[model samples]
Target: MTQPIFKDMLVLELASVLAGPSVGQFFAELGARVLKVENAATHGDVTRSWKLKAEPADTDTSAYFCAANWGKASLALNLTEPEQLQQLYTLVAQADVVIASYKPGDAERLQVNYEVLQCINPRLIYGHITGYGPDDARAGYDAVVQAESGFMYLNGDPGGEPLKMPVALMDILTAHQLKEGLLVALLQRERTGQGQLVQVSLLQAAVSALANQATNYLVAGQEPQRMGSEHPNIVPYGSVYTCRCGGKLVLAIGDDRQFRKLCAILGAESIAIDPKYKTNYERVQHRQELNQMLHQLIAQQDRGPLLQQLHAQHVPVGAVYTIPEVFAQPQARQLLLQHPGSKPGLRQVAFRLQGQQELDLSPPPTYDNYLS
Candidate 1:
């Protein structure tokens, strides 16, 4: 039997919504015993109410809440109550890590601040997630950070109204950063026997996620523009074209050879000979023209036959799959698990350690009895 990573480690999740809970969920997936603390006065996590159209309006369970709070026990407590605060203090004394998404000064007021918790348990790893920084009190909404951090500017079509990502990208990145920070803190405590404060903000995560786009602006003095399913650096990448069957196919032609092969497979070898489309750099420079040419060609043909040719030549082609189409896939089914009382098509935490992917499935807790 393979032992889980961070087995028996305790995580006190004082966070809510997506970011902090995401970190806790990752820890839980990694074998930590995570206890999610919700505010007794509120509707627990705000996401508990972020229901979709098909979900039961009367139920507290939600896709948004379930997405990040799996495999954790929930406890709702009022910080104002002395007995409840003492109960939390006892829990903190036993916990190895605490994750919080409180606004600027709220942590200190709630008495879950790092200084206080570390005093109670010197080995406690404290993590904080916020909108901008410790001094900024603004709430961290995904679209706001996406817009503020230049991420939105880099998304969507070049001339269309700048669009925010469909998913909570900034929060997701913040979770990854928090997870990394906590792991590092745990490692540091193992060596130095001292814990430290770790902080990550949505703005920081958004800016950092720019990757090469940030580099282009910072190092080369070039602002990134929206490309709309097109690659900024490579040509023919993200070039989606509709087929005769009304299905969409995307060609991911990275290098010159791949482009030449695609051209040959499409019986448009003249495209490969053209100076504007001969090399990767040339193709990038003439992306619009090249894509227009490929789009017309691919659009005229059926997706099935075109994809068969592309795959035979190994041109890295893929059919654009809708969400339902994605879930219907066999591989997607293998990645899914039967989580009770929530969504029917539940996905397992994405990790494949030693060819073993699924964890011991546990439903998210009902935080109902905690306040009572």
Candidate 2:
């Protein structure tokens, strides 16, 4: 069997919570040896205590903590203690990369900043995540960053209260951005024999992911408002319809041809050729009317049959699934990783490479499992 891409890499995770740990997990999933250092004074990562009401209070690990912490060994240390801090320095001297999520000044305060670590290992890539940026002192939280980055402003139903996404979207986005930056830094190191710091903030990452919505405001002078699952530019796209079977489905008719196909399946062939909804632009202008017609037609059909027909005809339609329903699909099941004693978790690395095989990764570690 072929070896994984990062088989010889060593990642030292000095970060807690989602973003930084997730980046570490990405490397871990690619076969890097990741060692996560947690605070002994605080009994490790704060997420270890972030449990659901149903979770056992006595355990050190929580479902939230396990989310981004698979395939790693854990070392608990008090950085304030010289002996413990020295151990970290020893590890830093040998690590290829260090992932940190310290606030603006905390890393410097702990003497683990890039400047200090660089002196220890010149080829070490340091990836840092913050709530805002290096200039900002406020602690970064995902929900707050979502609000500051304009995501909360543009999410949710029109005229309703702004809602943060169900997941830590800002943290997740920051992780992906940091991962890309770190990968580039590694490549640069290959060329120059030197590593540099890669920094990403949750706020900036969220703003960068705005994509077309930001352009709608910047180029067109149209400030986006909450439309609740509806895309501003495309009609019949992102609109959810409830069927007679009480199941909800969403449509993403990108082109006029697909729109026509969708209308034909709904038994509204006349609407497919209608001038008002013939093209996407015209349909956008008459979104309410077009959507109302489609809603009525869809409400009369069974969801399973309608979805099957849409799939067979190449119309982009999907059932709106709950979390459990999502995992019930075979495709979703294939992404799962089940350790011997822990609950199954999703693999962070989703992309496939040639001749890649399934990884046998260790479970998320218990506190200071490496010490034990």
Candidate 3:
């Protein structure tokens, strides 16, 4: 079997919550040795306390905590204390990378900032995450960043109040950004033999991920509004319909051909031939009427047969799935990682290298195992 990459690398994770830890886990998944340094005074990472009602209150691990932290050892330290700070510095002297998410001045105050740590190990790559930027002191929260970054504004129903996403989307996006930056820094280190600071702010990451939505405004002067699940540029895309059996599915008919195929399958070939619905542009212009007609036709058939027919026609469609239904799929079940005593966790490293075998990783660590 091919060995996992980064097996000899060492990473020190000084971040809490999602973004930084998720990056650490990414490296850990690639076979790096990651040490998660949590706040001793706080009893460890903050997410350890973010448990659901069904979770045990006495434990330091939570479902939220397990979401990003995997394949790593835990170390709880009071960084404000001189001795504990020295311990971290000792580790930094031999570390390859350090992941941190402290607010602007907190790391400096604790003397664990990149400036100080880089002095101990000139070749150490330091990855930092911030709320705004290096100059901003405000703490970053995912929901608040989602609102500030225009995501909340573009979400939700047309006339309803703006809604935050179900997951910590900004944090996840920031984590991915930092991962890419750190990987580039690593590649650069191979040439220069020196490490540099890699930084990402939640605000910037969110805005950068705006993708085509940002272009719709900047290039086309279209200020995007909440259209629920609808796409601004595509008609019949993101339209949801319920079948006679009450199962719901979403459509993503991209081009005129797919739309025509959909119409043919629904026995609405006349609609496909109509001048107003002949092309994607015209269909987009008359989307309200087209969607209404499609919805009614779809609601007449059973979902299973309709999905099979659509799949055979190469039309992009997906059934709306609940959490349980999602996990029930073979693909989703294959990604699950089972630890001996803890709740099952999903793998964060979704991409596999060619010829790479399944990774042998440890479960997310508990404070009791490493708090000394």
Candidate 4:
């Protein structure tokens, strides 16, 4: 594959927080020259303060900030100022793409709305990330959107509190949605010699993420119920058993063969042969009974040997890990990164292009050392 797919493109980012910045960051990683513009007078992106606490090996940069803006250039200009606003317009004239996530009406106030900018740069691919609809002024943070879009109610245990995901999953989904739209826009621009608007919202992203659950409700009239770690339609597909050594492990058996094999290994072949627990649909219908019986059988086996046995059979299984444990894995170490002379660690690019990989982890801007 060619190196730096967006090598010659310039992206002007007028967004903050996760979704909008994430879109720009992805393009930057793919080789776009991204200039992150923040209002000089404000604190800038909200995520800069989203850090809980500084790590000991701190570069005085927020850990959250490093996750998205590692390799981008930064320039601060208060858009309210006439000269600075004109400078931004000039930048937009030169940029191949422009992205923003300001609340509804803020773009028009700042003179960076798609209608306004598209007139200046005919080929500029513009992306807008919003919390709700373009005109909705409600705050569109992930948890809030999760609650609004029926996503939160599908998480956690059935009888327990409806849970929100710890990470900004809605925002992440919206970012991916925006990225997909922009890529398509870029391709279309290549053909038509014109750019178009790409818009995504956290509310819409949450609805899109409903994936199977939405279909289940639409097709079968089955409202999704939270099953904790368990999959609603898949039987024996969660951490359902405690080993003899007292450690818990997930047992992700999909097909009938895997289920039969699992039952055979547990010395409970009768369960697999039973008409009520034979096929996936039947097993899902009787999951509670199946889990109870397997739980008892699984307790007879040692954790180490049980895991090894599952691995030998190629059944999907794993022990849950804490955050520190997750990063301690060998795969995690390979992706850890640090900027030159910076003392803290950050996550490197998620993957590499086929061509030359630029491992530049330039520390996120300090505001004082603004990018040219």
Q: Where does candidate 3 stray beyond 4 Å?
A: none
Per-residue accuracy of model 3 over 123-185 as CA lDDT, tens digit each:
999999999999999999999999999999999999999999999999999999999999999
Give candidate 1 regions above 4 Å deviation: 340-348, 355-357, 369-372
Scanning candidate 1 in windows of ten residues, the lowest lDDT window is 340-349
Residue-level lDDT of model 1, residues 130-158, one tens digit each, is 99989899988988998999878777887
What TM-score goes with each of the models? 0.95, 0.98, 0.98, 0.93
Candidate 4 clashes: the total is: 0
Q: Which stretches of candidate 2 lie over 4 Å from their true place?
A: none
Better of 1 and 4 by TM-score: 1
Candidate 2 lDDT, 253-302, residue by residue in tens: 99999988888888889998999999999999999998999999999999
Worst 10 residues of 4 by lDDT: 52-61
Q: Which structure is stronger by lDDT: 1 or 3?
A: 3
Cα error, candidate 4, residue 349 (Å) = 5.5
Give all candidates' CA lDDT scores: 0.85, 0.93, 0.92, 0.82
Best model per lDDT: 2
